[model samples]
Target: MTPEAFFFEFPDGRKAQVALGDRFLVAVAPYRQRTHPCQVHYFSSCTGELREETFSVRVLEEGKEVLKAQVRTGKDGFFELWLPRNRRYTLEVRQGDWVAQGALTTFAQSPTCLTELRLSRR
Candidate 1:
């Protein structure tokens, strides 16, 4: 089955599309093991190229970051963070040299829910 897809809307009215499965692949560092999976997508108007990256997702409360222990997207084009247990936290997605950073408040119980993030350009 094809994975669900979501869109990241920017403040400038630009929307980038990301796939929850195929487009978002995870690769662990140091061990380079495939751990968590995420949803991510990246595109540049100047370069006109799209790349995908994935990484582990971590949920941070106040200031402490707790790894959600799930594979997340962190490629050059797309990324996602899986929140644990539905709480107010910050989600960060960095792809390749380009980093699209945004904060999303979501819940872990709502697995099928879509979290909207406003990311700044690199």
Candidate 2:
């Protein structure tokens, strides 16, 4: 038996890289647009169906919500969001029946920060 592998490609020649000074990175890639590299890929309402155009993001720290950012999916269904420094966040996105959730790590200048729900489904 052989292990199957997944591959991603980006279109529009746009790319996001985490620099030495940067603390966060986000990206979205859609099929049929062209092969590109993306940290995450979204599925359409139908299982196994690829989607393009729609995404949302949020940030949290120490289990406390902090920042929220909304993203518009491009023709290729790709979106990107940035977070503050030295903090953490719970990221969520919904597309039709499909929903994606994950945690993002960041940093804060102060030792204490506010907690709140930064993002939600509309």
Candidate 3:
């Protein structure tokens, strides 16, 4: 069975197409005069090595799970997603027995935000 997809509309009347199982950013930032996308890079916590692996990422808004996706990092351990500025979000990443999670709030003044997460074995 295919999972349900969720769509978010920006204040400017642009909608983001998000598929249920597809890898994408989970949060939607408010409409801004100038907007920037969010970029994330994942690394290994133990060896400080870049990892290109499939990981589960979930985005939470207001303490509710709003989006979930499975994303694979590129050879450079990089992925990109768009988020609304000035909003708080919970991001969780999991790979095998390793997990890393954090909270982020996109800045209203910046055109883009770059985040790096390192996963460690539990």
TM-score of each: 0.35, 0.41, 0.53
Compared with the true structure, model 3 gives a TM-score of 0.53
Off by over 4 Å in 2: 1-23, 29-52, 106-122
Global CA lDDT of candidate 2, please?
0.40
TM-score of structure candidate 2: 0.41
Q: Over the stretch 26-59, how does candidate 2's per-residue lDDT look in tens digits?
A: 4433233234332233322111113355544545
Per-residue lDDT of model 1, residues 54-86, tens digit only: 433554677787655434333333333433333
Ranking the candidates on lDDT from highest down gives: 3, 2, 1
| Ordered list by TM-score, greatest first | 3, 2, 1
What is the overall TM-score of model 1 with all chains considered together?
0.35
lDDT of each: 0.38, 0.40, 0.50
| Model 2 root mean square deviation, Cα atoms | 11.8
Cα RMSD for candidates in order: 12.7, 11.8, 12.5
Instruction: Judging by TM-score against the true structure, name the best candidate.
Output: 3
Poorest lDDT segment (10 consecutive residues) of candidate 3: 40-49
- C-alpha lDDT of residue 100 in model 2: 57
